[model samples]
Target: MQDTGSTVPRRQLGRYLLDWRTRAGLTLVTAAELLDISHSSLHRLEHGQTGRIKIGQVEAACELYGVPEELAAAFTGLARQSNGKSWWHEFGDLIPRDFDVYVGLESAAVGIATFQPELIPGLFQTGDYVRALNRAAFPNASEELQDAWVQLKLRRQHRVTRKHRPASVSAVIGEAALRRINGSPKVMAVQLRKLADMSTLPNVELRVLPFRAGFPTGLWVGPCVILDFGITPAGSPVEPPVVFIEGSTVGNLYLEKPHDVERYHRTYDRIRQRSLDAVSSRNLLRQVAKEYLA
Candidate 1:
């Protein structure tokens, strides 16, 4: 059960170090030499892979990279926050570093754009839907463990309904997601109804991509969540929108490069364009839910 808290701050810290080094035209070897540290250590520092960072090393980097006092102090601030603990640390072993980072970032995101091809999004999943999914997916696991997972899923939904400025959510779901029979028809019916209900919230938008639109090329990898953290604070200027790809065989992945973020944004726009409007999507959900109920 190892929880390294949110990786965002540390990753941000690493990113600044890298940016300053690049701006100063200092290579890994050059920066490491200036700081009297190994090139590998400098590389790791830039990637936020180190669990413990010596402040003296960072100070040396600030001097060599010619980082401004303000930016340097901000970097140090991120360094400290990166080491903060996770509130969900009780489920530490159950979470992967990448997924944990996504959760941490999601908690702080101002808005999220989600795309799903074959199943309900976690934020909107019902307890029964979650339990059934776990039961079918993890047949060997004890029911108690699966129940704990269901509770975890439920807790994650608080972000959408919290009183203190909930994240604005827009989900473009493929028709397959509506049609996929996860649990019993009853369970799915309940799930779809819940989705329609949630869609009415001012902060949530829902759409469905019918089969008529056809899937786009290079967009079928898997479901993804694109998170936007709003304006960059004075302290953190390099914080960019992130694209989180769900892994089929492993855990989640983060794509933060400009190109990666742009690619996902384009994909999201294209998919959204092809999907039914919010009202139409809600009608479709209700229609299908009636079929299940009937």
Candidate 2:
């Protein structure tokens, strides 16, 4: 997983600049004037929409905001990192625009909380499961694009599978997801075993929302992945926690607003309370796998 969200560095760098501007109590217009840049340009930079960012621009903005020396250093470093290349560029037209953002965040996140209501979440899905799902969803896609899509997903799994500094992922899967199998019976059987195996990894915690638990009132009724970055040196979040709402028609929606993040967090907590614990969840998965094997 590449740290560059959306195949560029601007998003995270822009976020840092936006934070600095807010901390300096400067509105977009005022900040633009202070930086001697156009208001639109400044806004784009803050939102990470710029494809080309000069290192000096980031440095100047950080200095103007009177950020501490170390924090300014952090900003400059991010600018450099964001400017670098990654594997996402190779896929070209195969990837979705907004989805790139989700991948980038997934790469950088230190803690992840995901709730899957229908199917296995992408990160945990096996290659065969992915092939089946992609084939069904994009029936007209080119062979090259299909292969690229699977590669993209497998690459993204690095967040959880990376041997060193693996991100802590707490996945709450609905029993319906486990039952409504993807791929063939054999493929699904393997996937179930994969889940049972992955759940035992130290950094991955798996729970199951059984059919018996039903649904909660506030649950927005879709799969969502919440990404949380660890704290920075100054005891603030390096990046604010983000909630990714899976979308089919509208692309992926990333919710960074405090309210949206809070709502999802609460819903996840409530649903988690109703779900089976890790041991029981794994047992259920293995039991389900037995049915398929039998």
Candidate 3:
């Protein structure tokens, strides 16, 4: 059995399997028995600690869990791709189409360091802003569909806002992102004010990279997020860090290599260094909101 170099996809797949199993109301031992696997083996697979994921076993488990056809296919696809060092979830691909692998990763992450060059990070986006973007992105979609998308974004924000163990967020937003008008001026004003308010949260550290900080990295950097899982009591990472790069036209990229993660961390550090401090950023956000209101 070959070891999977990166655990990102495996972890994501495990999360999905676990969710399905729980929803099916099956105990771990019962589910393992139904899938014809040992309890320890099933436990390992559910924890993303298994080696050489067998596609057949994944399919059997999905079948045993009564997962839908599309979702079952998606899980199998993830199992097939779990051996790679890095995973690119193409927008057109079956796995990404049926399931959002990134959301699972984000939910499991303990801390996130993100740099956004174009738009407000999803965690900080207001409902109106999200609705506006969704309407624009899916112009032919129904209002109900748009509302669903908006609600999804809002739910994702709970990661940073929940009362218990909210994830730590460090975000550096480009000035351009703040100035860009997605919805009406009123919407922008509300959105900016929300950003300012959210920045006040103890777990969130928000900064803005002004226009004056021209090309801190000597090049244009696209939106990227670094997700760090918490460490164990022994001081070792619970799971490896992943760098998620959002591709506007193609698909999302997950980099799990040490070098790739380190490079993005360095870039994020440089960008953060050039950004306004938390107080200054909050001030700028309010000032911008006032300008929008005016």
Candidate 4:
């Protein structure tokens, strides 16, 4: 079976199906029995692991779960898109095992809030910066493979750059990230300048958490991204917000519970409060870039 490459529609479809099934008070086994499928099959379908979801099955499940007509139609549409390929699928092997899921969510999000303490965020990285990071991470990889990874990074940036409905970005970077040299002084200079340039976009807001901020939360805060899907016409969120915590020694975490999401939001709010404003951040970036050149 061909991998579906972590398509967003499939994940959204699975989440909706799972929520409706639970609301209907049906256990997985019971739901599977009612839907005439094996328990494991239903499990995969609800978790977005099944490849090529059938529209008929989705429609049947929606009816069985007593899903509203409008939502049922939306569910069916998601099923239709479940088999479609995302651009990131081409570089699947080059990315981390679970990172594709993050890419999918990022693609579908209407707004993104990112906090990076140690390095520049991927969406704002320059091509040279990306190549340098990839080379460091995969020193033995071929030049062609590194180039492919750079392309993938550039493609991800389209979320912030596209002319139509560009995703709104609010990013807070620790002073360490600005000072840390990824490839070389020249590379860092260029990267910092690029960051300044990107910050000028109407959809992008950049802030700097200077060293003087002194850990506003009084604890170590790692890198995290909060993704917000836009709401529907009825004023209901299309999907709940998710907090993605990356760079754990174990593995990345995707926090979806309401309380967890709220906690991250509060944490981000506090961090943003301490960070320099957008104008100050832009000035800081240029100053540091000039320092690197000197």
Candidate 5:
């Protein structure tokens, strides 16, 4: 998958290379002539438009610019980061690259908040529900891809179960999620039971947004996820908070903008207000499960 998000490092590397070439008194055309590459090809490489960088080309550029060993190594690291096969590639090409970034971030998140309007969140999905959902979402996906998706979904369980700083999760699910039948009655029964079990985990908080709430904050926005990473004091690595919004075919990541983060935080709080308390939400899920038995 090609990562549309998290391109900051890529851009940084591009600027670094461009600056070096300029300091070496080489114009884009001259650099292209010297490297025996087209002007546009050199431009794209310098601008980070090229998704992958050739080690030889990078080394040649470094030599031309007399780049310090340390800086050259750093640039090489950035290129390597962008060149590796996507983590989701194991699921075949069905999962797009944008989603691969989300998977990477989700694995590193120390806390998460999600608003799911129609279906159970992926992290809590049962194997059968996961299989059914993936098939519906990707009708053309191969059986191997579907199986890989299921495996990945189940692997998310470890994030919330690990002993060292388990991820703290708070989810607001629509009541419709519980009322709708995703698969067979047995499948749903087991799914609901799994939800109940997950809810009891110390790090997980579940709330249901009942229809009667009447959109308290007008936060009828589609489902979204907010992930927060553990922050350290000054001198430590800086990992910023990020919000992810998904559409029909792509996903967007909002970071590096304080206003965007603040807006989402307010929106999340408003949505939470419309949701039932944890106890009530669990009761509602239980009632819905009983209805499935009838």
Candidate 6:
């Protein structure tokens, strides 16, 4: 009995091709020879490990494996999915692999709610702010790598600015974050002024949790993003909202469990309720910026 349990989609696609090849009495080397591709390449195809799978390669692999058109189509779809550029790919090796998944998720998310305590969120940071941050965060990063990371951060910020596909963003920052000077006073002033200007965007809702707001539960958790993947409606596939918590090294914790998602949603609501309104928040941010400017 061919065990099909625990087969991931990519692995299943690979197995489908492999079974076809075996039934056709073709060895891996023989199949590779017939396809005019390398044995190692064929092995990777069989294992579904090809990230940049060429159309010709999928077609050749299917043909050599005697795969049916429909089955071949499925594998081709998988190959295309594998070949799709993940958002983090823009950062190259500068971004750690664990953090890469969050970038990918952020790219696809339609709405975002964030509660940040220590620093500005990535999607809202200016290039100067991001440059300063990247330098501090990755002290060992090369200048070129820092530049690349900053560029990637700027591109991510465009999600809230793009005319057609803007993400609906709501950010609640702690008062301390606004008061803290990230870079030089001049640079910090520029970044804060940008934040003040951004508060007016129709799609953006910026709120600040003032020191007088008393303590809040959300404050204890550090920074987190609650991403809402718009509703699918009845009879459609439902992608539940997810909560992303950044980890220390590079990767982040993706919370998709219903209970965990609900917890963050509730937490965001509590923080929002406890925070100052948009107008007040903008004024507070400006006030802090003024202090830094002086």
Top candidate, metric TM-score: 3
Worst 10 residues of 3 by lDDT: 91-100
lDDT of 4 by residue, 28-140 (tens): 99999999999998888887778888888898999999998766766776676567554222232322343245666787799999999999999999999999988988899
Model 6 segments more than 4 A misplaced: 1-99, 233-238, 249-251
Best by lDDT: 3
Clashes (N, CA, C under 3 Å) per candidate: 0, 0, 0, 0, 0, 1
What TM-score quantifies how close candidate 4 is to the native fold? Answer: 0.71
lDDT tens digits by residue: candidate 1, 1-294: 666665555665676788789999988898898899999998988987887677778878888888877667655555655566632222334323322445556765788999988889999999999999888878999988998889988888999988888989999988998998998999999999999999999999999989888876534647999988777566553346778886755545566667878988888988898889999999999999999989
lDDT of 6 by residue, 181-243 (tens): 787877778777888899899999999888887677734767999887676767552345777
> Which tens-of-lDDT digit does each residue in 1-294 have in candidate 2?
433433234676676688789999999998888888899999888876776677888888998899877667656655664565532322333333423445656777899999998889888989889999999988999999889989998888877888999999999998988899787888889999999999999999999999888786543468889999889899997767878876666555567667978988988999899899999999999999989889
Writing each residue's lDDT as its tens digit, candidate 5 over 1-294 gives 654434434544666789899999999999888888888988988776887677677777888889887667666655655564421122334323423445656876788998888999988889999998888889999999999999998998789877888899999998788878887787787888788778888899999888888776754677888877767776552356667775564434335355876788888889888788888888877777777787
Spell out the clash pairs found in candidate 2. none
Candidate 1 shows a clash count of 0
Please give the TM-score that candidate 2 achieves against the real structure: 0.69
Instruction: After superposing candidate 1 on the true structure, give the runs of residues whose Cα lies further than 4 Å from its correct spot.
Output: 1-99, 216-221, 232-238
Error of 6 at 68 (Å): 28
> Candidate 4 — which pairs collide?
none
Positional deviation of 279 in candidate 3, in angstroms?
0.3
Q: In model 3, what lDDT does residue 48 have?
A: 94
The models' CA-based lDDT, in order, is 0.79, 0.79, 0.91, 0.84, 0.75, 0.73
